[model samples]
Target: MSTTTTAPATGTAGLPLADRTSGLVGSVIDSSTSLLAKQTHDIVRFAMGSPAADAIPTAALAEVARTALGVDRADAFDYAATEGDLPLREALVDMLADTTDATALDRVTITSGGMQGLDLACKLFVDPGDVVAVESPTYTNGSATALSYQADLLEIPVDEHGMDVEDLRGQAERTGKTPTVIYTVPTFQNPSGASLSLDRRHRLLALAREWGAVVIDDDPYGMLRFAGDPVPSLHELAAGDPLVFSVRTFSKIIAPGLRVGWVDTDPSLQPLLISAKQAMDTCTNLPAQRLVEGFLRGGYLAEHLARTRTAYRERKEAMQEALTEHFGGMARWTDPDGGFFLWITFDSPENNTEIDAAIDTEALFEVALAHGVAYIPGNAFSPSRRFPDALRVCFATTPPARIHEGVARLRRAVDELAGAAV
Candidate 1:
């Protein structure tokens, strides 16, 4: 008897996908990197929240790698502890000693990057149908991780002082549902670049305690502050509360390619995090951890941060100036003291009929790309698609001159779109 074989189904057509897979909403911010890489033109990148190429301490990292991952150090290539490499953990403890994010060894767990730390938080705290409150126009990647775990999201509004805690309270009351987890960037927030005010921070903690919610303090850019008074981190303000789960990364302050970050959780959760991490990645990349360890131990971070802070401050100013020069009549933007981005919202200038009455930034993105510039459409930042008239621009990656050029290109794109509409 000859048996005929059937070909297995490919893609999602006939395959059985998990119910949770539907929740795996990927990052548009990250996807932009690939999209820009495919282009051949000279485009000034203002999308990804990445450090400038010159801002990275390449020479210092190279020198550290010589000793940290020398040819003879074969063990550096092996698996690390599920919790983290001891040397690196110890270095982190020492590195954060004087900062607002200071923590002890038992509370720390190494992660693949800030993204993994976010994934781990959702994995541990969120369950199917659980409510997860996130900042409106939040870091979509973080919210995406929560979604991937089958959590229902509640978007809270964010203003210059960061997540409006009062709005959160009112929303919770109106919905009659308390969140299971509250996610915040807290300091130098991505896209908006706003920091949470001290009073709001305390109020948030109180509300989390009252609702029995876990606060995921995902602050990757806290250390990159270049202006204004340093506000206490949610982790610092928590004062050893187990409800606070802090996720930090070296990506912004250091090289993003290294893919190294850590979590400071309650010591009680360390074992659970280790078990969960082992089931996921086995361990964080050992080589990357070693490299970060060396970077911290060498006392290179302080100087590196200082230099990048100054550069970012200048770049932020340049972008603001360019925006004033070009879009001043029709757009308004946030003034963030630190971080990679500034959120821009378009509107009609009074007594000005030259520009379109309304600008859809999502429609304007492709036109901007064609004009040799790129930025994240505002809708991408909000899960609810609330900001069609806005967009996000990263002012950290380009130099002053290039920022001016990119802004000019963006203005041209807007004009081109307006002309087409007319």
Candidate 2:
């Protein structure tokens, strides 16, 4: 049975909330936006995972907007097809022809964004109390979406190669239950910035097939590769397998505020996807769809991606250098070839018994903010609050100089915390 909520009476102080809403956990990642907005300090923001302020092609978008939403075309403002705008869909199919995630016309369905894609996947597959496998240090919002559907989460451990598939199989077997949905960011994962290796990707698919589960391939950052060789996407390897449901977005590669994304599924499932979408928001915003269509058709994305890749590469290197200079032996971090994040954790001494090296990152958040730096605590990424000593820092949004400043501030924050502890 679907859990539903009733709205409170207009004059009432409190309303009856829904049972499903109890699991509606908010995103710490998004909360930082409002938190930072009120600050009067000159903070070096490393909190939000976004493109650098100068990275957005404002001039190009503004130029396109004139024609994409021209006064001459009244239909530009009308309701689009639930599947997607026809022109945008066609352009997308052509645009992805040489990419790792190429798909046919029938398999494409436009969505509001990648978040809605995850929600749709859960709504279509997840049942109340069904096991849903997720990475331990997964994107909290994705796991929260599953939780909202009342699904029981099985937190699989993640490493440099992404989710440990062998461990997942063993854990699932021991539980005597199979997961209905397996969610993965796959390439350049959010928070951790780890890509699933090819071997593990194949293994994950095998397990999902054996268990009759759907693979929610939520890859928003695959195309932003500034380093390393390309790993084939789960959608490509699946090769028309209906079990793989791929969610992609222009939010990362283009502008996030646009909120335009698409889901690539088996052709047979397109109708269901359309129906599911129709019952949600009627249709995605038409003007945004048209703008993206203009961008793609004008041959601007390739140049835009190339330019940003170079900038992001420089930014990532800056963050790594800053970490080495400031953090040194006190902490360790992941060196991602692409994507926007670097996961940092404190190094604990082997002989130390009285004090664990793990600083409570959650407790340190306020201190870091006061010191004019910010990062999402590792516990925010985990549903079970694991890794209290770690946090995620975004390098894509800040410049090289600001990155150094932020890390220095973070180091000072740690010193302040230590001083207070003493």
Candidate 3:
């Protein structure tokens, strides 16, 4: 009566695989969500770039869903247009009309999410061995998408003002090659929480024009500005330039679970985008698109953004205050005007010179997890395994008090690691 269990196949020993598989680097930031989910203990999560639970307009969404996906609305559950549901596309155009990312319906193609938009852009423009420039601490998913297309990534360093355009030029010069695709988060960049300066934006466009490179402007947080003056999006700056491919998502503003986003490309590329999307998913989830359309048409986004912006600003301040209180002498962090993350780098304090040189944030991750704190190690954001001394902390999901607790736990983890090294 005893049953023998067979071990599942391991590794890709005999399976036919393409060379592109080698470039399929996975995302540690996303894997952390799965890793943390299995833990039974209470962990103060500062890892995922997600909106707070309260930030999601659940009740409003539920009300919208009642109509958007009601039994009477049988078409709501049907497949959407490859370009996008017409109503949703119209709504999106209207929603963005007054914003820095304003766009036309002719250029919009609904995507599964921001990640899909990134993938689509790579699929369209990136050829095998093509040079792709990305920020040093870029969005893991974005860089991974480019890598999946067999792109040769050149990591450009980012400062408080965002991707260093001068360094980008210097690196291209050093390598004697220009990028085929320049991928940038630009506004409130992921991991670094830095926006590309106005001066740099112009320079980047000029460089792209000179190099004939396609600029993948992946901007998911441009509308979340809370602390600083608004900056024009690359989409806005390009002003109908076909070289700029703008990817946007409702995940940050609305809810990630909806998985609804869109790409604003040239009208000439719209047909190709539809073909690409049809080969992939046929179309975006119809119910989700309907829900987003309802949310947008009901005039709920403005109020929701205003409320969340205020809350995020307060949370960012709280996180900074906590960092100052605990690691004031031992660390430095970025001050983002409006975004979900703060980039923290361990520095050489006068009293603790060993910290900057010895402690590796990658190694400290396990210790931090045990201490009931979770943050993405800076190395996870880089393709070249750079930033061993730094990490990215997300303050958007956690409340002020929880943020304080999480920062304290992070400090304890650092102390534990520092003491172990000593």
Candidate 4:
């Protein structure tokens, strides 16, 4: 794990400074490990993972094919308007008509999915050496995007209430790091399932306004609420401004394959994002977009959400009950009102760290695999010892029996680890 070293080029201090550029050629080259990490193949995963639900309203799929092959029309052909098809765009506009009293269509931009929305945001704001604020633990994808851009990330610690506001302010004013944006997943957050307080939401917006830093509202799980009251979106609370944005996707509530997601940003930023969209893929998959367009437009979408929500609510209950019965005080976690995954904090004799601090090491993951269970570790979220003893488990993809079995497997793994120490 030792990294190779390359010393900085040195030139006569009295000589012209710009002449030293030639000596720096090999000094700043990208590392080989950076490339290999990107190429590393991951094992099959079921999260926080699940295949598309059975009730996808298949008639819409057939209709999409008909439209694509020109069986009924020729609209799917040619380079898509580079701004996405009008039908899908309008459908998105209609879908989010409920997003607020202040946000407008001119404020929305289409991208492949929430991931793309975030990538575009990072590309727009983060520059090498720029500071980016994130929840102490955050989505792995988002963190990677910032890091690849070489942005210096400052993590704002979190408690059960969500990201620490005071920590964020201190970082913003820190001498060395200059922050460009604040990224967050406020409701049913990934891996942590921590929801922000409404008061914190208002305070967060005000702080962003004061600091002139834009906030990226990554809320794919907001609508997945299973048992609690709703929190107003950052976009809704912040009013209209170039400084705040929200990224919403259909993946969770509908199907991940659709890749239809939009950003609620200032009107002035729309053209820039649309430009970024054109370069990414011109537009998202036409067939997928059309199928979702049909699905949402035909009016069966509401029923689809209700069906999934009810079933997922049951799964949530099972996860909670299983944790309480087994881990109990040994691990603490939020009973998410609604969302696909639950976050667990392991109370181990040793602190769970980014590497060996976690119980689910290479050995533990293998043990869980053999025991018919699997999960993503807490460190993977931010590569920090934020809570070395924490772990994330997903319940939405599996049925009741599988959920129970997975929890049992996790219990056995924990016991085995403790026994080895004894």
Candidate 5:
């Protein structure tokens, strides 16, 4: 698993890049923001899993920014403690006191975002060639982080109940290599919107225990649940086990631009997290921390979540209804209680292989974009290009009317692509 880099034969600059640079695979998800920004079309963007435009508490945030980041509070602009700003940490701890992911101040380290939390986890645990089990069609950024650390990724299957824990065991048995880390987005998973069942959750914990593996539980959408009973977070279920590292973010629940999130791990790991963070970005952005602190201190999150959950539930239902009307038997999608996405797989009664060939999501992306609609190709979610016939649609962004329009545009694009193929 050794990676070596050779300098370009003809390049005159003669700058030598580290071998690790080869492993720095970029995120298609993040790249879409730039790709979409450059386009001039009246596109219904279903690519980025951002909260709806109307869902963002802009006016409230502006007010918080004005007050919290004012010159009177000039200290907000200063460098923060590597652990995080104290006010934000205190607010977060108070905010999560009654929740399943509640933790003590010592265990919580505010991060730039959930992605940094993932990066930190990899930095702390992964070694070159270490086995890391990632859900098939997992979050690209999460998997990419592991790859950047030179971890040998094992893509595990995911069904309606989330990652197949039983299959994970079988795969480990077959490969004869125990995974050093099991990275999962267990609840309302990013692209799939599937929650791991309580039974499988227990099994995964047991397997991690046997393998002595760390579980990187990345749950950004847990609090936006609009339906179904709440499942305990991996951190809650682990009961302070050092093996469970939980990453939470305000990106999905509040605002992504704020880029504020936190990690909950064993108290012993906090010192290491601080040291690691110091060498990385020095500190999480201070002004953003103050803004988040202001938002939390003003008690805005509860009402915000209530409004967001209701809106997103309606949006999810709208997306499903549109898919039913347009796709019907042509495709199937996951029904998530809450989250920004629903994973769709193209299918047909004619033949599986033929239909899949007829509809390549990677190819369809351009067609859909040209037709004033956009979605993330299924292949982008998989490192092995496993779901070329699948795609992820974010249901939390557009309204019901726009959702229908976008689906109609997508259907037209699909038809055009299929016709052109013939």
Candidate 6:
């Protein structure tokens, strides 16, 4: 079941209720645009033509609801600390310690999600129009949020290992005023599906120090690693010396609806973030925090993560095989160690469409939708680059069977373009 509301005539314009909003929302049709509504059509999910619905762990969710309800529901209903309720904060501290420095406690703020956690970086560090170094094709949400704060988003190229350190150092030299922060997704990046090598991680932190800039490490997909040993978080590697905030999220692992995430960084920004947080939803839902805390305590999280890992790994395998079987010789994609995405890069010769056409790139988005499938184009994820033939396919939502069907449809679409060129 999906919710529905009348689409506003001028959504972004904010016209008077009585007046017609003739303003164009062309942004949604712009390849550079990032709209959660377009990216996630919760209002009309049935039109998506994908799986029935993501099966949430209802039993565990029920447990969480009941636990929070039972534990002084009146207090849980009250406003919580801007830093998040002390108990949830403590729980985060305990959970995050396994990944980073435990005693480096001064640098933790409970954010709504990795998205808000990243937004806090701009609020505290970046001034309007200030440049911020970002990996080319980093998460759009990060870039979009940065744009909202009026920062100049800089792009650094990424290889299989992740953000290029030499290019970053060169960019720093060119700017002379190192961006406020350098951001990267390190492991299991969004579209490229690349992970920063351990050496690159060390190199990045050192470059940030050299340029006198902070490192805004936004790593929501770190935990979903289906295979491979966990790398030390950027904060853990920096030893809390440089101004860095390691952002983590429980979305992919548990549920995005919960929106439980945290950022660990220097205490200098805490007061500012507390203020920004107050204006934005007043410390997140307190009762929600209590419920998530209960969920963590029940020991179901471990099993839940295990199940997610297994399921996603299988989905990844299915997508990988489909690409190989259906588009094998014609397409190339990076194999991720632990994440929900696989990026398909068609051979250049096979790509004839002049993506630079004045026409909005997002127009092609409707092509896939018409094909009874929906996916984010690569350009939206990487506005700073000419990555036209690339597309990101999420394996988290669709089941294995549909993964093949969707890829088959995509292959046909690509072939149609190739045939036109001939």
TM-score of each: 0.96, 0.95, 0.96, 0.83, 0.96, 0.84
Worst 10 residues of 3 by lDDT: 1-10
- Candidate 4 lands at a TM-score of 0.83
Backbone clash count for every predicted candidate, in the order shown: 0, 0, 0, 7, 0, 3
Residues 1-422 of candidate 4 have per-residue lDDT tens digits of 11122224444566554532332222011232242234334322224444235635466566655645465555655566655667777777776677552355577666788888888898788877777888977776676666656667788887777888877877666755546888898888876778888888888888888878879888887777768777787777877767887888877877777787777788888788878877778877776677777776777677877887888889888788887887765667777777777778775545432123335333455455555566765655663435445666777877776677778877787677656645
Candidate RMSDs in Å, in order, are 5.6, 3.9, 4.6, 7.0, 3.3, 6.0
Q: lDDT tens digits, residues 160-267, model 6?
A: 889988988787778775677787888788767688888999998887787788888877777777877777777678886746777877776667777778888778
Model 6 pairs in collision = 107-265, 161-195, 226-338
User: Model 1 compared with the native: what TM-score?
Assistant: 0.96
- Alpha carbon lDDT at 91, candidate 3: 95
Candidate 2, position 4, lDDT:
22
Better model by TM-score, 2 or 3? 3
Cα lDDT of model 5 by residue, 1-422, tens digit: 00111223432367566666666777888888888999998999899999998999888888998899887987888999999999899999999999998889889999999999999999999998999999998999998899899899999999999999999999999999799999999999988999999899999999999999999999999998999999999999999999999999999988899889999999999999999999999999999999899999988989999999999999999999999999886888999988889999998536543334357888888889999998998877777878877899999999999999999999999888887887
Query: Which regions of candidate 3 fall more than 4 Å away from where they truly are?
Result: 1-13, 349-357
Per-residue lDDT of candidate 2, residues 118-161 (tens digit): 88899899889999999979998898899889889999988999
Off by over 4 Å in 2: 1-14, 349-357
Output the lDDT of residue 377, model 1: 87
Error of 1 at 395 (Å): 0.6
Quality of model 1 by C-alpha lDDT: 0.89
Count of backbone collisions in candidate 4:
7
Better of 1 and 5 by TM-score: 1
- The list of candidate 1 runs beyond 4 A from truth reads 1-11, 348-354
lDDT string, candidate 3, 23-54, tens digits: 77777888888999998888999999999999
Local distance difference test values of all predictions, in order: 0.89, 0.88, 0.90, 0.68, 0.90, 0.68
Off by over 4 Å in 4: 1-46, 49-70, 100-102, 174-178, 350-363
RMSD of 5: 3.3
The sequence of per-residue lDDT tens digits that candidate 1 reaches over residues 1-422 is: 00111223334777787777777767788888889999998898998888999998999999999998999999999988899899999999999998999899999998999999999999999999999999998998988888889888899999999999999999989998789999999988887888999999999999999999999999998888889999999999999999999999999989899999999999999888988998899999999999999999999999999999999999999999999999877888999988899999887545344585578888888888999999998888777888888889999999999999999999899899998888
